[model samples]
Target: MRATLIYGAGDVRVEEVPDPELREPTDAIVRVVRSCVCGSDLWPYASRPATSEGGRIGHEFLGVVEEVGSEVSGLAAGDLVVAPFVWADNTCDFCSEGLQTSCRHGGGWGQDGVDGGQGEAVRVPQASGTLVKLPVGEDSELLPSLLTLSDVFPTGHHCAVTAGVDERTSVTVIGDGAVGLCAVLAAKRLGAERIVLMGRHAARTDLGREFGATDVVPERGEEGIAQVRDLTGGDGTHRVLECVGTKPALEMALGVIREGGAVSRVGVPQYEEGPMGVAEMFFRNITLTGGVAPARAYIEELLPDVLEGEVRPGRVFDRTVGLDEVPIGYREMADREALKVLVEP
Candidate 1:
């Protein structure tokens, strides 16, 4: 089997690797049909310590079950499924509390000791808990969208959920990347009356509008903050979804959320120093929440919506390539030429 391997920063290659087999009773082996490149993957691809041995490097995928272990009874061969980025036992306390990302067992993916989905086939741990069965047939064109259910869609949905977005709230989503755009859709589905999306890219902003962004702020940092405030008549929005985990974007989310409002941040934090101002949070009385998304928690609830086409989270994908073309896809994404790239194996 061939998989995407990252040897170091900006160096991703398509390399042949051994196929995976079910190693645990809770495991399932999946024949990947579609996989995607995530912004989160870029972080490690850009900063993980240099390694002499390249490792698998993708986490989001939709595939067909090829085999399942003894304990995995809910799924079987021929079932089409979406694998969440995190693998958990589902019965763990954190999973029960809706924080499966922090599950006590088998947490991270797409790194050392973990087989990622960006290959011909891969083994999924805790299969019954981690994989969501899609109603679409194996030959359905829904694979692209179903793939989004694996990570970005749920992660974006988490931001909205953490911020308490609902029918009465007016939301502001910062960033227009895949996750950010998906946040716009999630906010709409959650019944937000107004959605303000801040981004500069025309294509992405257009997608944001299609997804449900009522307003688009094409500025950065302080200027973007001012625009968001102006839209809300100086009160700011009731809830803000911060999907870009950067210093400027974080500050912007803090600046644009009203004093009693909340900010749900799903972006992977890069700054070691933390938010720009802790005092503002104290004085402003804003509630801050979010981290690695607990995707499994929302899969069952969101799956139906995907099947009904109520939410087209797959709109985030801007390009599709074969596994052999993954190298160019990575470069295109890193250079900001593509929003989300899907790779089929």
Candidate 2:
């Protein structure tokens, strides 16, 4: 078997590796049909310790169940499924509370949770808990959307949920990345009446509109805040989705949300004690919530939309390359030359 591995920053390669076998009765082996490079994968790609051997490097994927462990009763060989970025036991206390991201028994492939899915075939632990069966037929065109269920689609929906977005909410999404664009879709699905997207990229902004972003602001900093406020009748949006895990994006989200509004931030928090604009949040009495997206929790809710073509999240995929081209995809994404890159393993 061959899997994508990054020795360190800017050193991604596909190399032969031992094929994964059932190590636990709860595990299943999935033959990956499609996998994707995620923005979160870049954190380690850029900053993992040089001495730390790069591990398997992907979390989102759609695949066929090649083999299942004895304990995996709900799934079997030949089943097509979407594996969420976070692997978790759906029965855990945290999972019951809708925080599958913190499930105690499962973890994602190549991550703290378990092995990664960026290979020809990989191990998925707690199969029944982590994998969602897609309703599409074997030849259906829902593969792209099914692939998204693993991460971005659910992540976007989680951002909106954390932000408390609803039919009456006026939402502003920060960042034009895949997650940001998905947030636009999530906001619309959640029934936000007016959605504003703060992004400068023409292609991303256009897709943001297609995903239900009613307004687009190509500005940054205070200017961006002003633009969002102006669109919201000078009150700022009632809810803001912070999809970019950068200092600037966080600041913009905090600054642009209305008083008492909620700001849901799902961007992997990269900075320690980054500017959350506590002063503004405190003065305005806004609510703040966001964390690793509970991708597992959202799969059930959002999968139907993807299956029905109500939301075409595959629009975020700007490029598709073979496993060997992952290095190029990483560089292209890091250089901002592509929005999201899908890899066929």
Candidate 3:
């Protein structure tokens, strides 16, 4: 088997690795049919110190069940399924409350000896809880979109849901990355009438419009704030989705949100200090919310829409590569040459 490994900054390689096998009764082995590089994967690729022995990389994937552990039920060989970025035991209290990302027994891929998703196979612990079975097969045209359910789509939905986006609300989504674009789609699906996408790239923003962005702001900082405010009739949007986890992006989100509105951030926060102080939010009467998305909780709710072709989040994948070409895929995305890359193993 071969899997992607990051040896250091700007260095990603697909090399032969050991095959995965069930090590727990709740585990299942999935033969990956498709996987992809995530924007978050770039943080490590751009800054992690070099290492001689790199670890497995990737967390978004879907495939056929090759085997299931003794305790695993309601799933079996040949079942097509999507694996969420985080693996959680659905029986935990947090999971019961729809917060699987905080599950007591849950963890992320590429940790605790678990295989990463960008490989030939993955050992999925708590299979019954972590993997969602798809009604379609491996060859289905909806594979790419179904794969988004594993992470990006659910994450974008989380941003919208946390921001309180609905038909009555107006939204401004920050960032033009795949996640940002998906947030636009999610906002539309949730019935947001006015969506202002803050992105500089024409190509990506065009897709954002197709996904339902009513306006695109190609500026940043104060100029961007002015643009959004002008679009919203001099009053900032009622809700804002912060899809970029940086100080500037966070600042922009707060800057353009209505005084009584909320900002929901799903982007992987990259800063150490708080992006906004207590006084800042207090004075504005703004609500700040959103954390790691509980993707497991939203998969079932979003699956039917994807299957019905009402939303095609998969269009975000502007490039594709084989397992051996993953390093190139990473580079393309990192360089902004691609919006997202789909890895077909």
- Over 1-345, each residue of candidate 3 has an lDDT whose tens digit, in order, gives 888888999988888888998899999999999999999999998899999989778999999999999999999999999999999999989999999999999899987799989989999999999999999978999999999999999999999999999999999999999999999999999999999999999999999999999999999999999999998889899999999899899999988999889999999888877646666587778999998999999999999999999999999999999999999998999899999999999
- For candidate 3, what is the lDDT? 0.94
Clash pairs (backbone) in predicted model 3: none
Tens-digit lDDT string for candidate 1 (1-345): 898898888888898888888788988999999998999888977787888988788888889999999999789899998888888888889989998888888566665466877888888888888888888887887677788988999999999998999999999999899999989999999999799999999999999999999999999888888998899998899999999999788889888999888998999988877553557687788898988898989988888888888888988888989999988888888889999999978
* Clashes, model 1: 0
Each prediction's TM-score versus the true structure: 0.97, 0.96, 0.98
Ranked candidates, highest lDDT first:
3, 1, 2
Between candidates 1 and 2, which one is better according to TM-score? 1
Q: What is the C-alpha RMSD of each candidate to the true structure, in Å?
A: 1.3, 1.5, 0.9
Worst 10 residues of 1 by lDDT: 271-280
List of clashing residue pairs for candidate 2: 107-113, 109-115, 109-116, 110-115, 110-116
Pairs of colliding residues, candidate 1: none
Worst 10 residues of 2 by lDDT: 106-115
Q: What does candidate 2's lDDT look like per residue over 146-168, in tens digits? A: 88889998889999988899999
lDDT of each: 0.88, 0.87, 0.94
Give residue 90's error in model 2 in angstroms. 0.7
